[model samples]
Each structure stands twice: as C-alpha cells, then as structure tokens.
Target: MATYEDSKSPEGPSSYPISHTISASDESNTNMPSWDSDDDPKNPYNWPTSRKWALTCLAAFATFLTMMNGTMATVAHFEISEVFNISETSFPHSYWIVTTWALGGACSALFILPLAEDFGTRPVFLSTYLVFLCFLVPQAVAQNYATLVVTRFFAGGCAAILANTAAGVAGNVWSTEWSRSVPVSLYILGYMAGSSMGPVMGAAIFQSLGWRWIGYMQLIWFAALFPVYYFFFHETRGSAILTQQGKSKDKGNDSVGSEKTATTSTSSLRNLTASATRPMILFCTEPVLFVSTLWSAFTIGTLFLFTQSVEQVFMEIYDWSVTQTGFVQCAIVIGECIGWSLNFLSRKLYLTSTSRNTEVPGAPIPEARLYMAVFGGVFGISGGMFTYAWTSYPHIPWIAPAISLTMVGAGSVLVVSGVTDYVVDAYSHYAGSAMGAVATGENIFSAFLPLATFSMYNNLGLNWASTMLAFISLVLSLVPTLMFVWGKEVRARSTFMNEMTEDGSKRSDDMV
Candidate 1:
C-alpha cells in the first residue's frame, strides 16, 4: 500500500506555496511519483509564458462563446413568438427562451463545478461542451416551443462549466496576484463583452439569415472550436494531476487499497456533495459574503434585464428598427472595454495601499479592491440610470440614452470585478466556496429579474421603472463603500475568515 502525505487540503496548495510530497510503503521502500521540483515541467505554473497565455486565451474565448449563447437569442424573441403563435401579452413567456438559459446555468453550476474539481478541468470541460453541442442541434431544428426551451436549458447547463472554470484555468498557470489579474480580467472581459455583443450579432444575422441561423451560427462556431479545445487544452488542476501520478505509480498492484484509487466513484461522490453544499453553507453563514453577492447579483441581473428592456426602450421611444436597436448594444461593449482598462487603476491603488500598510508587509488589504466598485456604483450605475431614465424620449436624441448605457456597462464591470477580487483576497483558500456563493446569487438574479421587464416598463413607464432600478442600485452601491470602510472589522468577525486564518497559520507552522 502507498500512503501520500501533504499539509495542504485535498483541493491542493495555495498558489504561493512550495510544492511538497512524501511517500511510504508498507512492504517496500519505493519513491511515489510527484513533481520533481517547483520548476517541474508537469506543473502548469511552470509552463512557458507563451504557452500559458495561449491556453488562457483559449479558455477566455471559450467563455465568450458560452456567455454569448445565453443572449444571442434575445433579438429573435419576436420571431420565436410569431413562430410559436405567442401573443404580445405573452411576452414574459417568450422571454423564457432567454431566461431559462440563465436559469439552467445557475442550477447546473452547483453540480458541474463540483464535478470539475473532483475530476480534472480538461475532461469535464470537453465532456460538458460535447453535451452542450448535442443540445444545440435541437434548438436549430425544433418544431415546438417545448423542444427549444428544453434543449436550451440543457445546453446552458453544460455551458456553465466554461464560464465558471475559465478563470480557474488562468489561475492555474499564473500564480502571482498581479500577473494572474491580467488573465482573470481578460476572462471577465470576455464574459461582459460576449453578453453585450450577442444581441448585436444576432440582429445582423437575423436581418439577413433569420432566427434559425442564430442557432446555426452558434453550432458552427462551437463545433469548430471543439477540435481546438480537444487538441490544446490540458489539465490544470494540481490535485487532479497528483492523483493521476499516484494511480500510475500504483497501477496493477493488488495490495493498493480501494480508498487509494483516485477514480473511485465513492470518493468522487463525497467530494461532489461537499462541494455542492459548502457554497450554500458559507452563503448562509457569512454576512459580508451575502451582502457583497447580493450587490453583485443585482448588477449582473440588470445587465441581463437590458437584453429585453434595451430593445423595448429603443424600439418604442426611438422608433428604431430591430437592427438599429441591436447596434445600440455596442455602447455597452465600449463601456465594458473602458471598465476593463480601469482595473489597472484599481490594481495600482491596491498596491499603493498595500505598500503603506506596515502592519503586514506583503498581506493584501481586501478593502482596497472596493474603490472601483465605489466609483462604478455611484457614477457608473446610479448616475447612468438616472441619466438614461430622464433622457429616454423621442424628443431627446437617442444618443443620450445610448451613451448612458456606457456608464451602466462600465459601472457593472467595476462592481462585479471589485467584489470578486475582494472575496478572493478575504477568503484566501476558501475563495472558491465564497465565489460559488456569489455565482449562485448572480445567476439566480440573472435568471429571474428579466421576467419583470415588460411589466415594469409598461406599468411604471420608462422613467419610473428605470428610476426605480437606479434607486435600488444606489442603495446597493453603498455596500462597497461600507465594506471599504469596515472590511477589516467585518472580516475579523467572520467565522469562515477566522477558520481560513487558523488553517493558513497551521500550514505555515507545518512548513517551518
């Protein structure tokens, strides 16, 4: 029998830690396989710079495609409604075509992400992507609404893996905080950009090729990339790699315990269950996490809500055609790009604050991450919403409301990014569970918030409806500032944070 020992949790070591491994055998002295050194080629963190970036870009592009699929169907809602004999009064039902995609993503992530952690990212990614593509075929040729909705649900479930795991892939290769931020930001850009561009692309395609081609184009693009993913994407999870090494070393040895088998279904199930539950547990128990996630979720939810509201606002107030309305989404894309660039400024502020804090020389001050969110919430989201609401009139140039979207987009990106960075820094190794909590809230908001689009616009009118959301956002926007002011005190009070600190101390002591 082979026994493996390491101080790190089964999820693997922290990004900064030195690699450690030890082996012992009951019947003989044999060296178990492990990374040869910190510079081992088998370790993703040691991969060449070019190779690391290539894979990161590949993962980012994949995330873009999956996110785009969620909203590319937005422009075609009218056509889909017509084809299915759905009435204008049934707008909410037709909206489900888009909503279910997000709903599926939300529900499926709890299970899919856990599976990726237990297995390896490469296998789970390839397998889910294959399943996603299979489901896409039905959407292209579906004869009934049921087929379309059902297939999209399953497809979105599969697509969730890419959006959630792409950043993890980037983190696998770049272990440093600042360097890792670049690729992580790239992935975040891909996500926001994809959502913004989907309607634009869908409109052009719908104008020339019609609604069916939207599905066809997705099929073609996803299929073409399948080969790229299969050929180039490699496993990045460290624990999964180590487990494989252990299995290869012990293969064909009957004395090896069943519990030691890396692929044992029983252990995998336990991991999956634990992974699925921990996020919710943390979410329920952690006040700071709950507030931050709720704020971030509202911003994300607003982004999705725009898929419907933007079209309606422009078509009604600007008298713009569907194609013209689709182009308006470009403003959001431009804003997202600007927001991406602004992250560098946030990083600079973070570094400056860290340098000034002599209490812990190299420790991150998580509150510094909230600066962007403060600017974004106050100026970007709230200010933009107020501007967009009042300027939305046929008498007012469409450009006014359109430009306001830039603020909304920029603000949304900043808030989401700031909150994510703070969670990662504050929670440390438990960041995954903290993030899982955030993702769940964000997805749920993305899924359900849009259901009220038409009702809100029609009942409250554009001015009040927009103002209502803006006010809500204004209130939520205060969260980041509050966190920035009291984050240290808040974190000190957290049970999860204390546990993380204690565990980290134990690991350091073990190393000493």
Candidate 2:
C-alpha cells in the first residue's frame, strides 16, 4: 500500500506515494527502482562531492561555449562586412549580426524549455548541441549577408538550450538553496567569461587567420566537447527518473504503478505546457517578477550596448588596432571577477544570517537576495557609466574609463544573479519557467538594444550618450532597492510563490 507522511522534515513534504513494505519482499519488488531513501545512491543529491563537481564543470563548459559563440562574431563584424561589400556607413546594421543570435535564443527558449520539462534535460542537452553543429557548417561557408545572418539565427536558437537549461541542471543535481550557490555561481562565471573572452578570441583569430576561421574554430570546439558531454551526463530530473522507475516495474504485479505512471506523465506534460506559457502570465501579474525582469533586461541591454560601442570608442579615440581594442574589453572580465567575489561574500552573509535560526529551512528572505543587487545596481553601474562617460577624451588616460567597465560588469552580475536566485527560491519546482521568463526579457533586450549604440554615440556624442545611459541605469537601480524594501509584501500575494512555499518548505512562514 502507498503511504503518506506529514511532518515538518528537512526533505520537505512527502507528496510522493511510497510503498513502505517493498523493502521486506525482495522478489516481488525486485524490479522497483525508485530512490531507496532520501539518501539513495541513485539520487544526484547523495552523489559524492567529486561527482557533483563533474556535472558542474560539464554544464559550465557548455555555458561558456554558447555565450562565447554569441559574441565571437562581434570583433569579426568589420571583416565580414568588408567581404560582403558593405560600407562603414552601414555598420549599425551589422549589429543585427550579433543581435539575431540572442533574438533566436529568446524565441527558441519559449518552446525548448517546456519540452525540456517534459522529456528530460538530458535529451534537450544532447539534441541542441547537434543543432549547433549543423548551423556552424552553413555559417562557415556562407558567401553573402543573408546566408550568414540566417545561419547565425538558427545556430543561436539551437544553442539557447545551454543558457536556458544549465541552471536547471544545477537545480536538479543540488536540491538545497545553499548547496546550489557555488555551482550556480561557477556556471555564471563561465557564462560571463565567455562573453568577455569572445571578442578577444575573435579579434586575434580574424586579424591573424581571417574571419572564416572564427566559424571553423567554433566547429572544432563543439566537436571536441560533444563526446565529453554525452559520456559524463546522467538523468537528474526527479520526475523523469520516477517515470523510468514506473516503466521498469514488472507487468503483472505493477498494475497500480502503471496507472500512476500514466497519471505522472500526463501531469508532467501539463506542467511543461504550463511552464511555457506561465512566464507570460507572471510577467504581467507578479510584481516582483516584473521588477526583477525589467532590471535584469535593462542591465543586459546596457552590457550589449557597451559591447558594440567599446571597440569603437577605443579604436577611434586611442587609435588602437582591432586586436588591442579586443584586449581592452578585459575591463569587463575584471569587473566580473569582482562581482563573483561579491557574490561569494553575499552567500556567506546569507548563510550566516540565516544560521541563527536553523529551525526554518528553504531559501532565506527574498529581500536578502536583493541587498547586494540594490547596492550594485545603484552605485557600481551608475558610477562606472558616469566615470566612463566624461573621461573618454584623447588626452585622458584610457585606464580611467576602463576602470569603469569593471564596475559595470560587477553591478550587472550582482543584479542578475541576485534576482535569479530570488526567483529560483520563490518558484522552486517551476524555477525553470521563472528563469525562462527572465531570460526571455534579458535576451530580447540583448538582441535589439545594440542596434542603436552607434547612432546614439554618433548623434549625441560620446559624453552625453553614455551620460544618458548612466542616467537610465541610475533610475532602474531603484528597482532592486524597492524590492529589497518591500519584496515580502510583493511575494506574499504571488500564487506561484505561495504554492511553492506552502508545499511544506520552511520558507513559507519565515515572514522575511
């Protein structure tokens, strides 16, 4: 008989039915393959520390490749434009070359994430990499603007799975909020490093070997990584693992299990579909989500804006070569390192503050996640933008403005990571969809915003144009501050947050 338990346990609610007697009868239950206990060897949660790190490294590697591909073409834009017979006068249009990748990711994640929820992260992970390879071949040999743009678009759509689902993989393997921080932070580090490194790598390759080698290099790397991915990865999604266990049961004696299997599959499908569409609803209805999405999207938009404008600024004012300009982009990387450090410190603060009351569990107060973000968004980004804005003259030391890039990078990650962790806690099982909602907005901004970078810089002039951006960043910084102050009130009314909380997690009554 199936059993139910309802006590406040560290594992949360015992929602799943368990056959308590199965362990006593070896033969009759021999085929059953569900987790033996919360500490079962098959559960990713109970895996050795070495094993967990392996999964983290694999996911981070994939994230790096995806993000690297997105921006590698940025530094090669001039060469690609020259070959297509396009003029510097039309350079702004070339932003589409970069934008389309993010646009494709934004569009594809809507469907891909849902399917991942249904089938399992393992299938989506493998299939999308194949899609990446397929598009790289066309992009490598493309002779015209249309071919290159179309190929990059599809390649980006395929690669969306990596950015959208890697965190979900981390979520699957590490069940607790605190346990997830380091791995998730590492994944974000790889992702940001890829974005920072893309231009540098592309610039070196294009200057030495020409633009086509960019695609060739990407293909070679993907080919090398695919095998590592296929071999090391295992199924970590709990629902999917349970479904497999149901299928493995003996036919005659497992009638009840079969019926339960059908019900679980159907329910999973419904949840998948719901997750696909739920972001739209939450975007409109959930105040916290709305604010967090807007802040992150704007931060990403500014980052892309810098990506397009930074090379031009250094090249035009400092008269740096393309390769040198790419090196200058390291400002953002330094900033990201600092941001990661701040994230580490923030995690320590969160753990220490909450440890005072180990009686409760789940994520700490949602607002606690926003404290660093509020400060980061308000000061780090605004300070960097203003400093960079006015300091960009031929006489001023380039290091002055470059230092500002570090601040921008730090602020962006703090805001992005903080808001993301907040949403992940708030929406737990549906974290995939919650994160998808955020990525949808973030990528949409990334896709379209850079197109105006040159126009703004040229028409408004450098100081004022960047000043304008700084003003906007300063204004939006209020979002996280507001969230930090009133986040609980905002979360209290959220149906999704409440459901996840009341599902027997200690976070529900913490009243933070």
Candidate 3:
C-alpha cells in the first residue's frame, strides 16, 4: 500500500512524485504550471548529476568564447584607432566593436529565442553557433575597416542564441532550488576569464604575435568547445522536450510542435512564417515583457558605455602602458565576478531559509532578486560612477578611482543576474521573448553609445562625463525596482505576461 500525507506541510516529496504530495502554498497556487512534467522521472531534470554538470561546463565554455569575441578589441582599441586612421577628434570607431555585436544579438534574439517552442533547443543551438563561427574567419583577415565591422555585427547576431537563451537552459535543467548557482558560477567565471583574457592575452600577443592573431585565438577556443556542445548539451526545455518524450511513452500522436508541423505539412511554409513572427508580435504587443526588456537593455547599454569610455580615462590621464592599462581594466571583470559570487550566496541563503521555515512558505517574488539590483544601481552605476568621475584627474593617484571601478563592475553583475533571474521567474514562458524585446534596445544603446562617447568626453571633460552617465544609470535603475516590487500586478494587467502566469499557456512555443 502507498502512503500519502493528509496534513499539508511546506515541504513535500523529495523524490520523483512532487505532484503526489504538493503543499497548497501560495495564493497564486491557482496559476501554477502542471507539476506533472516537473515530476516526470524521465525528464532531463532527473538526469544523472554527471550529465547535468557536463552540460553546464559546455555552456560555460561556449559562453566564454562568445564573450571574448564581444570584448576582444577593448585593450587593442588604441592600436585599432591608429590603424583605421580615424581622426584625433573622434575615436568613436571603437564603439562598433561592442555596439554592432550587441545590435546583432538583439536582432536575432527577437526571433531565435521564441523558436525554442517550435524547434527545440538542441537543433537551434547547434545550427546557430556553428554557423556563426564562419563570420569570424573574414573578420580576422579583413582588408578594410567596413568589412570587419559588418561581419562582427553578423557574428553578434548568431551569438544571440548562446547569450540570451543560456540562462533559461540553466533554469530548466535542474530541480534543486539553488541549482542555478552552479551554472551562474560557471558562466560568470567564463565571462571574467574572457573579458580579462582580451587584454592580458592581447598584450602578450602584441608583444610576440600580431593583433590579428587575437581573432585566431578565438578560433582555437571555438575548436575546443564545439565538440563539447555537440556531445553534451541536451534539450532541457520542460514542455517541448518532455512532451516529445511523452509521445514516445504514449504510443499515440507526435509531440506538440511536431504534431502542428506534421498536420500543417502542406502549409509548412505558412506555419514557419507564423512561428517566426511570434517573437516580433510578442515584442510590440506585450507590457510586462517590454518593461523587463527595457531594464535589460538599459543595463546592457550602460555596461558597454563604461567599457568604451573607461579605456581612454586610464590611458590618457594616467599614462599607463597597454599591459598596465589592462590590469586596471581587471577591476571590471573583478567587480562582475564579485557580483556573481554575492548572487550565488544570496541564492544559497534563500534555500537555507526555505529549509528552516517548514510550516510557513513564501512565493518566490521577483524582487527577491531586486536587493542585488539595488546594489548594482546604487554602488555599481551611481556610486562607482561618481567615484571614478570625480577623481579621474591626473593629479590623484590612479588607484583611488580604480578601486571604485570595482563597485560598478560588481553592481553590474547584480543588475544582470538579478534582472535575468527575476524576468525568467516572473514570465517563465516568455522569458526569451521578453529578453529579445529588451535586448533589441540594449544592443541599440550599446552600439550607438560608442558613436558619441568620444564627443561627450571631449565636450564635457572626464569628471562631468562620468557624472552624467552615473546619473543616467541611477535614474534607470528604478526600472528594475518598480518591476520587482509591483511586477505581479503589472503581469496581471498585461496580455503578454498572461501567457506565462496562466497554467494553460502553451509551453512548446519557446525557442531553445
């Protein structure tokens, strides 16, 4: 005879049958997604630990390589400026390195992320990442400036799959509450390694090899990570993957997206068109998603804006050599690493609290992540900016503002991790679509900001320019705060968020 609990407790089954003994916890219990898929023994969530960690490492590696491509030019910006014969009055050409890639990722995420619903993660991911690598070949060997810029933008477009959707993969792959920490650590570690690698690695290469080899270095990383992706990364989306596996078990119809495609075989063309346009429709129509995207985009824009502008401040004012300049640049990556570490700790704390309070439970508010958002806003952007801005003068020791640099970098970590975690939690279904919407703005701001950074610094001077951008970041940080506090109400009012909040919304619609 099987046993069941008549009395409810906050914590339920620790094993396969999560549905068998679920506690009636939060008021939004009416809107919870089916615990059925979540409890499926055959689900990827139930995969062996070795397999899951393998996949996590693969994502970490791939993410590292892609990010390196994103920031490879930062340390080399001075050399790149001279090579292009750009005017002394404007070194805005440097912005193209970051902005174009951001724009590309934004444009592609708009459509690609939503495709997980129809196509599945593995198919879309392998296809996009492999194809994106081709553009780098031309970029490394480009004869003129225009060609490199255009190809970089196209490469960034392909990166949308890797960067935007990786988090969702992390969320979907595990069952433990703080399982997110493992992936977050791996991802952040890869990110810091990549960003820091650009300068330290670049300095070494410039000393012995050529700057063009920096692009080739990415190719080496590509070769190493590609096989890992092919063999290890499995489809982890709860709805699409599980539904298909369920079909194999049922001996009935094909999976959801499969069934739709098969039935509409004669009109496959029409089906594909409709599916492709879904994210674009989501972008224009949704409110909760749009707001989330706005916050994500602004955060992205500010990060790149700091990247482009900071190099000049260090080089011109402090008179640091390329290698020393790169060390100073370490503060950004250090800050991000610190931010991720705190987030990891915060997740662990939440888990501990949940474990202790057995009778009473709480809904996982998106704002649970917002405390870090506040830190990122106040310290990372505003305070860090002020510290760096007010003291950027040549007279003061360089290390003073340099120490403050870590705050912004660290704060940025919170901003990114918090918004990412919150939006995915709040709008689980359309997290990708919402991300796409916001990324579109983010990449645009990132790309466009560099175009004017030189002029702004020229006219405003270092102190005022840093102050101005700091103030802008302070104002925009409120966006996330409002969402965290009132996001539930906002989601209730919007049709877009309705899809994620309601139980019946189609799960197979998300892109991998």
List model 2 lDDT by residue over 19-88, tens digit each.
0000111112223355667777766667788887887788777777788888887877777777887676
Winner by TM-score between candidate 3 and candidate 2: 2
In terms of lDDT, which candidate is stronger, 1 or 3?
1
Candidate 3 local lDDT, 1-512, one digit each (tens):
00111111111111000001111121112322333544455566676778777776776666666766776666666666678765555456655766777678766655445444344557777887777778778766877677778898888877656654453455455544445456655565564445444565665665566667777777777767778778777776544454465455556554755764565353434534543564467667766556655665665566566565766788789877765666566777777777767876656443333333222233233345566676677778689989989888889999888777788777776776666555544544444444444556666776776667778888999889889978877876766677645656776777655443442112211201
Candidate 3 CA-lDDT value: 0.59
Please list the C-alpha lDDT of all candidates, in the order they appear: 0.74, 0.69, 0.59
**Sorted on lDDT, highest at the top, how do the candidates line up?**
1, 2, 3
Pick by TM-score: which candidate is best?
Answer: 1
Candidate 2's displacement at residue 184, Å, is 0.7
Q: In model 2, state the lDDT of residue 330.
A: 81
Clashes of each: 0, 0, 12
- The prediction achieving the highest lDDT against the true structure is 1
Model 2: pairs clashing at backbone N, Cα or C within 3 Å: none
Off by over 4 Å in 3: 1-42, 81-88, 165-168, 184-200, 234-261, 264-291, 348-361, 479-492, 496-512
Model 1, TM vs. native: 0.90
